[model samples]
Target: MIVRPSLTRSIPFWILLVASLAVTVAGAAIVATTLPAMIAGLDDQTATGGLVYGGQSWITIGSGLLAAGLVGLFVLLALAAARSFLPVVKPTADAIEADDAETGDDTVLVRTDEVVPARDEVPAAR
Candidate 1:
């Protein structure tokens, strides 16, 4: 029952976006820093066992956080698309009048109860 506008404008949308981005960035920073260190540790001649294990642990945590952030973003996208099928709201009377003034639509409809002559009876083009 939630409308598209209300859902997007709601607090949850911003919260999700901020939280997701924060998590993703944090994850990316951790992985970016650790991956290089881990690679160096593996190549070092006397690298301690702790360095490799610690780096691997951090990398795992960072990967998990990155996945979580991506999933959150996907959920946000789905929520935004969920109500897209709903038609847009009609313009208000004031808005309609404003548009009419700006666009200058001179066409008008006339209604009559009387019957008019057939096309055959009408005069030909001059």
Candidate 2:
């Protein structure tokens, strides 16, 4: 797909933040300019005030969306980086062989799903 410049991945959070601020300021300016005229003509001060409030509300919504998008972008970037840096992470057989040879750990067989003995079966703690 198109991996365009994103906030967290490429464009950076600070740029997105600046964009949010600019959009918010522009929206606020539009509301501020319209409110006085709305008050004079419509004679509804509350509605006039609500114009700015609505602008702010929508700005907050846009910021939240931007943040979410950026977070996802960053996660993808991180996953890609990790995949590249740590490809095919298989355990080396030589290490296991060395451990078995040196420590006689072959027969120990530390099973991951081994059941633990109950308190009665276990030796009492001094």
Candidate 3:
């Protein structure tokens, strides 16, 4: 059976996603409000100053785009990494009791196996 995680159970994932979005929006807002003032400060008497300021603006914009892209890439990577570490919910004895009550069978068999051995232990010879 394929089990999908519920939103209530995945609170941390949702929190991280919301926090990332909030930070991105805050960063964009700061840049939008400050960039023009920064460009104006770069102006000087020489004609080359205007060219320099324009180039600076483009460079700032390019760097911001690159940073945003990198942040997105990293966030995606973090989510992928987090997927591998999601919490596993084990069925409690209460659940088994409910199952038994419905089926009129007291016996419920559960089998579990360890996939990995302890690192300190030596492997068995074939």
Candidate 4:
């Protein structure tokens, strides 16, 4: 029996990998965009509490997302490296025999100095 890699085992990991990357990037972008505004608005009394609080909230959420994504990515990569996330292919005796028979021995040896005629152009023995 020829063992093929199963997609069912790998599809979820692939989805998780993509999702983790997207979440990481989105978190980084949110933090990057929110920091400058919060810093710039710190002087105004009206912007101090509400603006700073909202920005801090976003920053916290973004940091959490970034951390979660990083942890997920690390775990997935480790699992992949350890071969836990990949499908294993096992070769059976029947498969080995079939492969061998399919590739029957047809090896030929020829010296560099000897000229070998093409099969279609070979002369018949007299």
Candidate 5:
């Protein structure tokens, strides 16, 4: 019997792909809709724009790094999933011959020396 491995058949691969895509889209949306408003609000509240700009720069860098890390994790998961679907090679002729020699008999032998007592022969508990 021969079995083939498939990535599409694996549940983990699809799960990871979906989760990564969701995180990427949601993160991007949140940043896009909120970053500008937050920066503007901070600038208005603060006496100097420099502090707000610096904070925004750090936030942008941190978000970029987080996105990159998520992407890297997704790629790693994909690679691991792909590794499971690698092709299987057939056994060599020598290996087949050795296996056949090791188990040449098709019939199995059994021994029946022990016997069990009938239900009527057992004593009831007090």
Candidate 6:
């Protein structure tokens, strides 16, 4: 028995995985089945046949590495972008002392203490 997940989350990833696997499998099957014919047609060119298999193998290997590299690149890019938007925070005493800023210097305190405690209170015996 298979459990189904909601469309909002699991479906998209499953769909992509299934589709990619199907395409890769079907493509490899086609390439495998066609390789001999292709080689024979091209006068038994071993180099070409090897190149075809090698290319597919490289594509398989490169896919994971490419995905990882791109993910890492994007993470770095996102971090850099976020850093640009953030205010520089000073830490050391020297840096803190070097800071000079001016504002109205007025502070407002908001008092919020009108009582509404709980709904489950019972009167105590006096």
User: Which candidate wins on TM-score?
Assistant: 1
Superposed by TM-score, candidate 5 places the C-alpha of residue 14 at a distance from the truth, in angstroms, of: 0.2
Instruction: Please give, for residues 16-84, the per-residue lDDT of candidate 3 as tens digits.
Output: 566666656665665665555555665643445555666567556655754675586577567767665
Instruction: After the best TM-score superposition of candidate 2, give how far the Cα of residue 43 lies from its true spot, in angstroms.
Output: 19
True lDDT of residue 13, candidate 6: 48
Please report the candidate that would top lDDT against the real structure. Answer: 1
- lDDT per residue for candidate 4 within 30-76, as digits (tens), equals 89888878988875544667779999999999888888889889988
TM-score preference between candidates 2 and 3, better one: 3
- Model 1: runs farther than 4 Å from truth? 1-7, 89-126
Candidates' TM-scores? Answer: 0.63, 0.33, 0.38, 0.60, 0.42, 0.32
Instruction: Return whichever of 1 and 6 wins on lDDT.
Output: 1
Candidate 3: stretches off by over 4 Å: 1-9, 44-76, 81-126
- Report the poorest 10 consecutive residues by lDDT, candidate 6: 104-113
Q: Which stretches of candidate 4 lie over 4 Å from their true place?
A: 1-9, 43-46, 84-90, 93-126
> Against the correct fold, how does model 5 do in TM-score?
0.42
In candidate 1 the C-alpha lDDT for residue 23 amounts to 93
The lDDT of model 5 is: 0.58
Clashing residue pairs for model 1:
none
Query: How well does candidate 6 score on lDDT at residue 22?
Result: 57
Task: Output the worst ten-in-a-row residue range by lDDT, candidate 4.
Answer: 106-115
TM-score of 1: 0.63
Report how far residue 18 has shifted in candidate 4, in Å: 0.8
